[model samples]
Target chain A: MSEPRFSVGQRVQIADRTPPVHHRVPSYAKGHVGVVERVCGMHANPELCIRGDGKPFQRIYRVRIPQTDLWAPYEGTDGDKLEIEIFEHWLELAQ
Target chain B: MTGHDDHDHGRTFQPDHPEPTSDAALVGLALRELLIEGGHYTAEEELAVIAEMQGASPENGGKIVARAWTDPEYKKRLLINGKDSIKELGFDLEPYEFTVMENTDQVHNVIVCTLCSCYPRALLGMSPAWYKSRNYRSRVVREPRAVLSEFGVDLSDDVDVRVHDSTAELRYMVLPQRPAGTDNWSEDDLAALITRDSLIGTQRDLSTK
Candidate 1:
């Protein structure tokens, strides 16, 4: 079993690559930075699972991105947040 | 009714749209018949599973929330292990991760799945059409407070609003605080007040005094 790449509260950024097939990462979340809120359990890449690709699994993390960071015209207060479940393969440690 | 049918003549009624069948539905129908023909399972057994699905309504979630409200230990267990805690109540939330996000006086929480319509169908049955709408999927994550206000949930500015986007495999449900006036209410009574929207965090006011 592979160890989780990121921990809760760690800063990470979503990878910007565009896969040709189905993937869990949303277009809106691509290339964005967020804080890991929870290390949700590991699971096979849903894109592969749907295709019966028989690929190994990776850890899924719940990352909390601030609304203001996601949208420049965000109207809510500063503390507002949007949390998304992202797989470990799509994330990298932020500087 | 027979006289009315005679007046309508031998012509059968034809609606504008033919029941709006989709490719997915047709595929599902074919798969079911194929499975039955192969002797994998009888149609009667399939109906039993259908019956089980019919029982997967928000009422089960209400029972969990109500129990959590009355039992502190149960609430802790739910926060830590939502799947196991729900199973303790004889509810099945299998093949998915069930996470309970608690709403406290300091903060408010709402759930949305921005990527496709992933939800806790085993616990809440089919998600409302609005929950699956593209407009909602896009707007809620960007403007949760504004969207929530449209649902008649206007939290004060001081309270932080957190919108959870269930983008991947896990599913989320809100664990709203027990309303103030319901301190003396029984578990069953409290469960009655729990709305599907509240379980999803679109609404929080559950006081029934």
Candidate 2:
């Protein structure tokens, strides 16, 4: 019964660490900073649930990250953004 | 009407990648027959489900979008609770919750499933092959504006582009801005302009027609 770590509009960073197997967290988002757009509710972690192992539901958030921050050579417009759903455990409060 | 003796087997043989050549089809047929014989699920039920899925298409989503365009209250309800609002149209949205992202004059929205190809199948039917391609999955987030331009949706630098990745159970659809010069157009006329790609946020100018 842990409380949600991040709030809407709060800045956070996805953990850069790689897991042993496939995960929902995309590689492009790792180590990138974003702001929580919406609290999308708790859901079973696919990494564990897909393996048929019973796991606790984790808080999911819709995080909005600037496209420029994600790709170093990104030449898109400045206002472009990329939003991804991230699990609470995979995110940490951005410095 | 050609005889088997006259058929050239060598010509049909593929080298690098061989086709299944009915072997896989036979196995699938056998498995399906076994399942039906075991009463696991009736063949009728399977056909009914297939028919139900076939009945679903972008038209369903188009109807919703058309209604939202003319009715402000329904639009508000759709934005607040997408699943329930869609259910109001007598459609069942199961397994995944649905969300509608609004495309205003200043901001536009696009959807992608970076993990796997998750989408609003109940409303919009199957996603296009391009939506599931690795090229799209890898580039859209990194270069949204560029990717959109390839789809013929060019936006000004001032307008913001938002990309929503379907990482969870929730599914998203875009509510594109209503086209102009069709103020008094019927619901059917308005719905006709909403294309499958338009619902995905790839094309913005629906007024072209």
Candidate 3:
């Protein structure tokens, strides 16, 4: 498997795609920008273009973002943040 | 802890359904028996764990909440990496490891595992039946604040609701902020204020109110 392109503290954005039927990615986070918090090693990639191939690929990263970035309209006293695990394929370097 | 019964085990066979246990039930029964036979735990210890598993008592979560309430530095550590921080409190994360997230005024946190029930079993014990149900997994992400309200957890409209979807590998636990009325309270007193429902985002920390 290839090493993940992104590193901790690197800014990245979620790829644009129709959500998978059974996905670990949350629906609210699609197309959002966040910073990589941790590289959670690699695992068998679940999003296979064709099913039953049994070819495993992909690394997962833990990403963090201020709550305001995800929810623009959010207004709260304490600045909150969220951390999510995103597969390699779902991320692209933010320009 | 005070209002609700800590633990209760009472069941009588109902006349409507009189049948032998199914394969699934047998498998579950055998799994428990094997655990004891393997010397993984004493029968009494197994029962205690099982009771917590059944949601009779949320021992681990209560401890986490207590530490967060009393210790500022520990709370920071918990927010960063819940699994290791909880171990510092003398709780084992062996059976099930967990990822802890915090929710503040600006952000609200909720957890769901879409494919299967992935939960912080080490800290929160076994996931509740409701957490495993499809209804919760499907609806929480779509309408988090509304769903929380149904459970009597009504957040202010301004609070951002962030729902976490756990996959097969990782599980999530939400650490709510400490309540206000707990000034000068001991760790034990603060722990008593945490409930199983609170950890799951179904209820708030009663100490705050």
lDDT of each: 0.84, 0.83, 0.69
Best by lDDT: 1
Q: What share of the true interface contacts does candidate 1 keep?
A: 0.90
lDDT of 3 by residue, A12-94 (tens): 99876775545567666778898897776565556563475325756888777666666655543233455677888889998
Write one digit per residue (lDDT tens) for candidate 1, span B59-98.
Answer: 8889999999999999999998787888999886676788
DockQ comparison, 1 vs 3, better candidate = 1
lDDT of 2 by residue, A19-41 (tens): 88667888878899999988766
**Candidate 3 chain B: worst 10 consecutive residues by lDDT?**
B6-15
Tens-place lDDT digits, model 2, residues B1-209: 23436643322222243434687765766776677658797666776776677778999999999999999999999998888899988876765678899999999999998888888887999889999999997777777888999999988977899999888778999999998788899999899888999899888878746
Q: Which residue pairs collide, candidate 2?
A: none
Q: Model 3, stretches more than 4 Å misplaced?
A: A1-4, A8-38, A41-58, A63-83, B1-57, B94-97, B207-209
For model 3, residues B19-88, the per-residue Cα lDDT tens digits are 4378886676577556655878655675566555555346678888778867889888877766578788
Error (Å) of candidate 2 at residue A55 is 3.2
RMSD of 3: 8.7
Q: How many backbone clashes does candidate 3 have?
A: 1
How displaced is residue B104 in candidate 2, in Å?
A: 1.4
